[model samples]
Target: MAIRRALISVSDKTGIVEFARELAAAGVQIISTGGTHSLLEKEGIPVIGISEVTGFPEIMDGRVKTLHPAVHSGLLAVRDNEEHQRAIRELGLDYIDLVVVNLYPFAATIAKPDVTYEDAIENIDIGGPTMLRSAAKNHAFVTVVVDAADYEGVLGEIKQGGDTSLDTRKRLAAKVFRHTGAYDALIGDYLSKLGGDPLPERYTVTYEKVQDLRYGENPHQRAAFYRRPLASEGNVTTAEQLHGKELSYNNINDANAALAIVKEFSEPAVVAVKHMNPCGVGVGADIHEAYQKAYAADPTSIFGGIVAANRMIGEETAQLLSEIFLEIILAPDYTPEALDILSRKKNIRLLRTGELASAEGRKSDWVVTSVEGGMVVQESDVHSISEADLKVVTERQPTAEEMKQLLFGWKVVKHVKSNAILLAKDDRTVGVGAGQMNRVGAARIAIEQAGEQAKGAALASDAFFPMGDTVELAAKAGITAIIQPGGSIKDEESIRAANEHGIAMVFTGVRHFKH
Candidate 1:
């Protein structure tokens, strides 16, 4: 069948007029609906309204316009089948060769803080998806286009060859399915929030293909980046690269972890992450001082690690960072001099993530992990565990300085993978034990790393101690006080151990398990 009819309807009218004019020059009849029709008419292009073709007026504020059998029959009819041609001839339906559509702004509408329930419900599109599905199903005869970005490619193909190839149509059909799947997932997420369901009865996720990476965790495995289904304006997916080489899989992972930890501090702060764990973190008067202190905390572990700063990168900070072999460095902005200095290192991945602190509030959901065939999801360990939330379980209460260190350690430990332990003194990390098999083993590693520093340092655990062994180990390590989420069945035994060792202990009602 020769391409003759094209349907054009879109919310994002970015270059639609030129695209439609090109189709018209190719002798394709343009059929559009409501606002799109008016926009095309204003451009002096002849466009037939869907109501005229269907012989029915748009009812219910134009919601009932394109849902008619005539609209779908044209898109679904096969050009090569005699029976389909016969039915189209009998029903007097014109063949629709292409469909151009972008759904309503449901995600954007619901994202607004002042959006009402009724407003969000109305933004949920129905006819757009119906037409898209019909055009996608009959890809042999119809071409489907969802995003405006595809307009140029589709027009290029049609201009080069009189019609789009079968391969292009098949690829566009797959994109249409993905488009509808993502749209539905956004709706499900919205409804789930209005109601009180943490997880939908069935899980549906949508991801748009962003780019293929150099490799996965290792160079041998394949990898790619996908944006979250209904992500807000600014996220890791939307970050910009001011300069430097492309990011690897581990670089993105460690950068994300570092960014999450840096956002927790309201003041000038720096966090260094290695292997998806915070190796060094510090807050100070200036970004330069913060970087120096964070680097000094553990210079050995900071090697080849990802560093995140909450403030602009100064020349001094950049010079300090340039001295090390760093994998990635992210900050709100880099001074021109700082960029010039850092750009000298060609392989370093420098990303300007521009005030993504606002994006942190949008992520309250859990981190998900997939196994051989099943998956598990839990809430993110971002809950602010305040000192007031602690219930001094042991007879001895933490001293003023110990309580401050306990709070500092608690904040840092939340970003570590469980079973995790963090030892800190004077609001700086002395040692970290992350992703250990058991709690006691993690405690031992933390103390061993701290060495003599453990004598005055306080320890923070991500979860409740199952047994008293971890508490006993902390006592033997000379830890002055300990803070953990106390919810074990043997909570009394752990408390007894802390008291027996004369160590101050506080039980925070909240747990900060990261894994």
Candidate 2:
């Protein structure tokens, strides 16, 4: 097929003028609609108005333009079919060999701080996607273009020959559908969210590629990072990497885990994470104190771990952090001296999430995990509890200091894997046992890690103890107070064990289970 006629309509008029000029210079007739026509006329280029092609003026504010039978017949007609050509001839329709179109600025419009719902709904383009899809469906005969960056190459191919190659047309056609599909998915998601249904009957999400990682979990696997457009503030994807080498798969996962833990605290806090679990967490009067306490909590696991802080990092804290080998340091911001000192470590990833780190939460409360054939989507474990929410169910009441430590411990335990136990002292985690097979085993690991520190520490369990065995072991380790959901069938036995050991037991009535 020869490139005798081209349709040009675009919301983003980046290189359309030059592209259209080249097309016209190549003796290809240009047909455009609305703003594109005015632009081409003002640029002194000979172009046919869309009204002339459709034989009808645009109505309903140009929304009905190019949606008539003339445009569809030209795009859908099979060039080599005698019957189709006869129908075209009888209907007085000509072939549109090329289509260059892009959808409206729906994504950017919705991202604005104060955009109205009417404005966002009005920006959805109906005719543009229909035209693109029509042209793409007949890709064997029609050449479609959606991206501005492809203008030069596409024009080169057309200039070299009379028409684009079949391979190029197929590739561009695939791109057109993907572009239009993503556009429709965005609109659907926006409307579904406005409908106030968190889990609709059908859910669709689209992401843009951020970068290709060095590798996945292992050297043999390939991986790339994709982030949702318009992600909420203070997200790991939204964090700025100021210095260091590119992030690895494990680095991003560990960093995200650290961020989740740090986001739970409003005051100065630090969380050191390893293998997608928090090894140490601490909250203090200042960042330096918090960092020191976190480092002291688990010195062995702190090596080459990801550290997230909710406050600005300064020179003093940087000096302490420089003593250890950490894979990453994420904070709200960094002082000049702190950045200078940390940037020297060429392989350490430094992430700045801005002030939102102090108050930022996830965009949605949904967590999705893949299984063999499908995914299981459930609400995220964002359950929170206050001091007032804790019910003292045992004879012994926790001291004010113990209450603070238990709250801090509760925050950290939620982020740990199931069968999790965290021993906290002085608002810092003395030890954490995660992903164990049984409650007693998890308690033993936590107690052994805490060692002498477990004597007066507060133990926080992600779920109720299946039996009194965990409490018996905690009593032997001298754990003074305990926090658990207290919903187990053996809850009475566990409460009796707490009373016998003179331990303070509080029931949260809420469980935080992370697998």
Candidate 3:
């Protein structure tokens, strides 16, 4: 079909002027409204106002405009159908060959720090989406353009032959639908969140693709990274890769996990992660000492793991890290000597994430997991278990030093996958068992790894003990103190086991089950 009339309306006026001018120069009539009309006319591009086409003034803050038969019938009419053509002629409605529209800045408006509900509602576009949907639905005869990025190619196709190919039109139509879907999803998500609804009647989420990874968790799997438009501060989603290769899917996931765990500490801390669980974590007087303790915790698992540091990486830490085979190293800042030493590894990815902040005391958010047919959304288990939150459940009370280790192990266990167990001593994790089928299994792994080190260490379980077996096993492995969420019906059995072995056990009453 030959192009004759085109409508242009956009809130993002990116390349609209030059695009509209090209359309006008190509002998196509241009119809525009509001800001677009003013912009095109100011640029000396001949344009017909929407009021002229609809034979009605824009009313109700321009909301009543473009909802007329003149726009929709023209866009929806099928050219080859004789009845459709006859109906348009009888109604004196001209066919709109192309529609170029972008919606209101609802997302931007809501992103403002102090935006009100009324301000956000007013920015919702009605006419723009109506025209876009109408034209895109009839893409076989009418072309639709929603993104400014497509302007050059669309204008080129029109300039060459006054017609866009069916394939191009179809692609553009798909883009229009996707754009509108994301726009509406953002609106829905923002409104639902503002209303303080934990789980709305409908869940709507929109993400912009960041990049396609070289591979997923495995080489054969394909994967991509996406981010929410309004990403919060100090998240791995906003991390900047300072050096080395593009991140693989596993690298991104592991790095994110490492970052989150490291941020849990307020002191000089370091965490090494593998397969979404921390292999080693430590807090020390300095960054170098933290790295040394963390590396010593699990040397084998630290190989090829993603490492994160809460403090700036000094030369000594950099030199030590360079000795290992790491996939990624992240820090808020790195000394010049440290960067120079680490950059020698050709394949290692270095990221500079500025000032990792603890989410403590913030409004808790949701953690979503996808099932086969649906998703499970629940409040994030960001709850922490400090010394004050613990209740001494055993007859023997924990010593001051044991209490400190117990709190440290408690924080580490929260980041581990469910059925998790962590053994800690002197503010450093000696061993961690994650994502095991049973609590006893996790306990065995952690205790065996700790071996002689477990003699005076504290053990933290992510959840309540199902039976006395784990406590018995810990006692035999020489674990002196234990911390867990105590709510299981068989809690008495575990408490009896602890008391029998003279082990100090504390219950936080708060569970941290990560999966």
Best by TM-score: 2
Candidate 3, residues 1-515, lDDT tens digits: the string is 78999999999999899899888889999999998999999999999999999999999888899999988999999999999999998999899999999999998998899999999999999999999999999999999999989999998998888899999999999999999999999888887778887589888777899998888878898899998888766667888888998988888889889987887788898999999999999999999999998998999999999999988998889999999899999999899999999999999999999888764643466767899999988886567756888899999999999999998888788999989999999778998988999999999999888878888899999999999999999999889999999999999999999999999999999888787
RMSD after CA superposition, every candidate: 2.5, 1.6, 1.7
* lDDT of model 3 at position 365: 69
lDDT by residue (130-226, candidate 1, tens digit) is 9999999999888999977888998988888767889999999999998888898889977886788867678666677778899999978999988
In candidate 3, which residue pairs get closer than 3 Å at backbone N, Cα or C atoms, i.e. clash? none
Clashes of 2: 0
> What's model 3's TM-score?
0.96
The C-alpha local distance difference test score for the whole of candidate 3 amounts to 0.90
Residue 451 in model 2: shift from native, Å?
1.2
Give a tens-digit lDDT track for model 2, residues 1-515.
67999999999999999999999999999999999999999999999999999899999998899999999999999988999999999989999999999999999999999999999999999999999999999999999999999999999998998799999999999999999988998999899879987678877767888999999999999999878878777868989999988899989889889988898898899999999999888889999999999999999999999999999999999988988899999999999999999988878889999875343344336666779987788876666788999999999999999999898899889999999999999889998999999988889999999999999999999999999999999999999999999998999999999999999999999998889
| Runs in model 3 lying further than 4 Å from the true structure | none
TM-scores of all predicted structures: 0.92, 0.96, 0.96
RMSD of 2: 1.6
Candidate 2 positional error at 283, Å:
1.3
Distance (Å) between predicted and true CA of 134, model 2?
Answer: 0.9
**Best-performing candidate as measured by lDDT:** 2
Error of 1 at 225 (Å): 1.2
